[model samples]
Target: MSPTEPIYIADETVRALIDEQFPELAGRELGRRYTLEDQFAMRIGDDYGAIFPRLPGRDEHYARVVDLITPHVDRWTFPSSHPIATGVPGHGFPYHWTLVQWISASTAGFVPLHAESARPLGEALREVHTPSPADAPLNPRTGLGLPELEDQFSSLLAFACDRGAPENRSIDADAARAIYEEGEAASQDVSFTWTHGRLEPRAILSDQGAFAGILLWHNFGAGDPAADLGYAANLLSRDMHPHFWAGYGDVSEATAARARAFQVFAALRHIQIDDPFLMRMAWERLMELGLVHEA
Candidate 1:
């Protein structure tokens, strides 16, 4: 990275973490991604790579997620986990940092993604959705059931309306409401399972159109398995859905219904957060699902 480049963590901080944790790799080179905010990946003299992302909370939970994934990804050749969310207490350096063998300097973001990657990504995510053990971290937020999700959506819509729902031709307020309500109605007594809670497109990686690796283990937990699919619904094109689901395994009509409901829920979240790109995709999905008016 250029000296002029803006960084989430200063070079000295990143260097200090490396020196303190894995001193052998200290003073190599530090590079930060322009597109990925608050994250950095370093080249450990080739064949080895590690990333330190700023995961601010849930340190104990994050550790478990990485532990669960370590065995699963062994065959995939992912980095071994040497994660350190912060320096040892009283060491004075308080920041989040984790070290794992970098999968490859060239990740999925290096190139334009294609539909073919959807299936592999589906299968990979399916592997991640395996049943969580009894001791698994059950964060209240992600472990939320239908009622919690409903309340969240209601609050989001109410907040938006309070702000005058801001004018935007891209999203129809009535349509947004319809989709949100429809999602809530469909989410009756839904079961929960292991899920990658925040599997947005950026969290996935690929190389030359093949599934490279998955990133960010902080959000993996026992919750709605449909959560990631909901994210995918708003993030991917309609044409890719079939291929993506094909790799995710057979979905019963009931599961499909729940997935659609979650998708609507996810869309409203995009709008609530004011993420333009996802908001655009979510609105398109709302229209395609007939949750929104044809206009």
Candidate 2:
């Protein structure tokens, strides 16, 4: 199906589902539906939301599924009236959803638009990382404690495992066990965790060297910065540019390590979700870059 078609279909589907599930929303008119290359979007009157059924390998992880839906709901709470809100949701589902809701409510009358007026990959990252008050309530799921991080990491890993790839249909009991154990080890290692305040963008300049809003994703909290960085780095390796990282702050060795680890985990997780496109792309890239070993 064409990208745009899905938006209309999904919008209709969501509207119908919502109407059936919650009749209070039945009379509300959902606005125009638009399709992007990877997602289906709709405007509920002036309210903006999206349906991302195309996200590669997403169906397998309930957390990821919730993550996708959370943003659409959060945006409804605070539509971006301002040219930019300076803070927007980033990576991971629950946290991103929670953060977006918090920022929207805190600002009250403000609407957070894409940074730099036009959305660019780099600027989007900067927006998420722009720090809020230090006393801001940390996401309960990703607070300072190691136990929480480990539990979340393991749960994500387990979810990934449950969504094993076609080749991994049998599910290797040993590998699953190892992942849990290693997840614990990684969480216990304080060096693996790096703390930041919020998501930030890596802006791309226009021909006049003016700020162009680009890549944005969350970049705060105490956890393996490398894991987060590595997740981004793999995306960069695929086609994302270094200019995006240029706007990011210093990258420590520890951060790089964490990023690398996260990259592999993300790859596996994506594969588990049966996202043929992402899986094929990741495997091909790994082979091309000599990152994967042939047995």
Which candidate comes out best when scored by lDDT?
Answer: 1
User: What ranges in model 1 sit over 4 Å off?
Assistant: 1-8, 34-56, 75-92, 105-112, 139-142, 158-192, 208-210, 272-276, 291-295
Report, for all candidates in order, the number of backbone clashes.
2, 34
lDDT of 2 by residue, 85-192 (tens): 121122222111111111112110012222232224333433333333445434322234333445544665566455543343333435544543444345333342
- Candidate 2's error at 263, in angstroms? 1.4
- Computed on alpha carbons, the lDDT of every model, listed in order, comes to 0.57, 0.36
All models, RMSD in angstroms: 5.5, 12.0
What is the per-residue lDDT of model 1 for residues 179-278, given as tens digits with 9 covering 90 to 100? 5555445644445666666555455665675656666555566776766667665556688888888988876554566567667666666656544555
What TM-score does each of the candidates earn? 0.74, 0.42
Give candidate 1's total backbone clashes.
2
